[model samples]
Target: MRVAVLGGGLQGCCVALALAERGIDAAIFDRNDQLLSRAAVANEGKIHLGYMYANDVSYSTARMMMQGALAFAPFFARHLGSSQDSLSISRPAAYVVHRDSQRSPGQVSQYLKTVHGLIREASGRRGDAYFGRDLTTAPRMWSEAEREAEFDPQIALAAFDTAEVAIDPAALAGAVRSRIEADPRIDVRLQHQVTSVDDADGFDVVLQARCGILRERFDHVVNALWDGRFAINETRGLRPDRPWLHRLKYGVSFRLPRGTSLPPSATFVSGPFGEVVSYADGLTYLTWYPVCLQGISTDVTPPEWPTYPAEPLRSDLLQGTLKAMAQFVPCLRGLDPGGLEEVTVKGGVIVAWGETDIYDPRSELHRRFEIGVTSRGRFHSVDPGKLTMAPYFAEVCAGRILQDIVR
Candidate 1:
């Protein structure tokens, strides 16, 4: 049987690959000219272990993230046909708690310890390694002297070094694309925007392309579009039942000059601060929430925004991101922006279940346990909330769809 995987981002590609492996012919539809060119390639690829969601006191978000993080290495290694060590893994992150963060240092520290304990237990039980690293030890908090030396004391209240690391999504996307191209059962349909889906024994997927509208029938359909997922789901009478937000967040990527030194890739915690990641491959990524965040929409479909900012606006974002990041990573304070090589600014739409932003201590953004595969008979809608959840949730979506066929 043939399957239709809507949207060729990471989630769609993963689902397509999984189905192809099962001897099912699958077609992937995307608006971009190429696969994995949108949100899948943009943004910092943080394989979160739930340390950032300190405000979610229930620990559910952290637990869900840990499960996905554990499965990330093996899942991609199997699909990409490469060893986990070959992936571009960033340096372990030092989570710094800001002086005015929504959660206190003590509260954040307690939450991290609890999450780490769960991670260790789950890893041991399944014998699943996180990026091939040994996570037997707990995260270590920095001393006052160490914290002062690594970060500006005025902004940073405390720091902890965890085994959490980020994979370069750009590199990972290339590997995934190669695998998809080599697979015979998976078809890649570029520049095809899925306008809607209708029930017709199976499903009829309507598409909008330059040539005009087109339609195709499939035994099953998966709604995996991040940009217009809600709109397509609504066409199938599956409107959202809860409050949500589609936030457009930006990230800056630049290459550092030779022999440039930087602190460990760090993330400021429990609020709308920012993060600075210096990858081993000489590429540095910076994102300051207050400046890089562009727009937010509560509608089923978010308003269109340029993925790449032009002119002085782009320069403003780069300068502002670095300046804001330096508030915590003191080493970047006086670095000349001109010295940075190949600087580029790009962002993607982030769909989450929240009415407010992360600034609020009580915002639903603090937790992300509400996402995954949701199905209504033969049609499925997936919301892989973060990049970390894409592979794991894709497996779930594929398995559930296969089970439906058996019955």
Candidate 2:
């Protein structure tokens, strides 16, 4: 049978590829003329290894996520590149930063031990393990990191090197596109947006385009539109969940000064939302780990919310990013920091909510990607399954939906 997959971001691409592999007819309908626009392109490309969540989550949850992260490298290898240019993993793994919060040094030490233990366990034998440290490298590397991407010594409580990585979003989109297009059975419609869906024998789908409205019927419709969840549910005559609101964020891209040398490939600072990643091209810089998470309290949600609007490059956002970045990377301080250049910003959407209007990062609610179904199970909408977790998530989603139908 044929199925229509809505949206063409990473999760959508993964789902479509999975369906085509299953010998089922799958078509991708996307609004943008190109693939992986919106949040996909803006993704700072961190393939988490559970280090970021060790202090905030249970050992079991962290362990599961770590194993899940390992899937990304194999997946990328199958789809990513040639010898000349490739999507290799990030260097220097990551740094779990600490702040002047309630968590003490003793507590921080225990958490690092736990994270390192998991890394050793994943290696297949019980053995001793260690982590990398030193915020300041040598006179050379330290000078470079300071001049290029600043790393503050005090912000880090403990530093650990785990089996995590980062990949180029552009390369990823290309690989998926190549694989999907190679399948003669699949049809990919560009500039076509799935407007809505309804129930008949299966489901009637509506499409909106510059050419006008078009409609079709499909046995199953997978709503992989990241931010379109609320509207799609209404298509099935369901009341929208007021609690499911989109939280806005941003990805700031910038460059370091010329005649400068960078210390490492990627560095994730823990204290404040800070990250400095050297892209595959090996020269550009991006602030990872948006420090804005703390501004959002546990109890604040809409109607009484203090969240940023869904706007990009606004004065407030630009200033906010600059201020946040400087906090963890002091080298970035200057009226006209000649060291940093070409600052650009992109808007991002987090398809999540603070339960009852209270946002808690530690809660399972914000930790995992969301997959939901209509009351009758005829229609489904997926949250943004991060790049690292997309492959596994796609398999689970596809198997659950198609397994019953095949039987």
- Per-candidate Cα lDDT values, in order, are 0.87, 0.56
For each of the candidates, the C-alpha root-mean-square deviation to the true structure, in angstroms, is 1.3, 6.5
The TM-scores, one per candidate, come to 0.97, 0.75
For candidate 1, the per-residue lDDT at 160 reads 93
Evaluated with lDDT, which candidate comes out highest?
Answer: 1
Q: Candidate 2 on 42-147: residue-level lDDT in tens?
A: 6667766555553454665456455556555554444443521454444545454445533454554466567666655663431211112221221121333333
* Cα error of candidate 2 at position 207, Å: 1.3
Expressed as tens digits, the lDDT of each residue in 1-407 for candidate 1 is: 77999999999998998887677789999998889987888778999988889998999999899888988887888877654456788888998899889989899899889999989887886654687787877888999999999888878888999988898888888888888988999999999989999878788999999999998999899989987799999998888788999898899988877776765688898889888777877788889999999899998889877778887878899998888777668777767887789887988899999889998889999889999999888788999999898888888988987887788
Instruction: After the best TM-score superposition of candidate 1, give how far the Cα of residue 317 lies from its true spot, in angstroms.
Output: 0.6
Q: Report model 2's TM-score to 2 decimal places.
A: 0.75
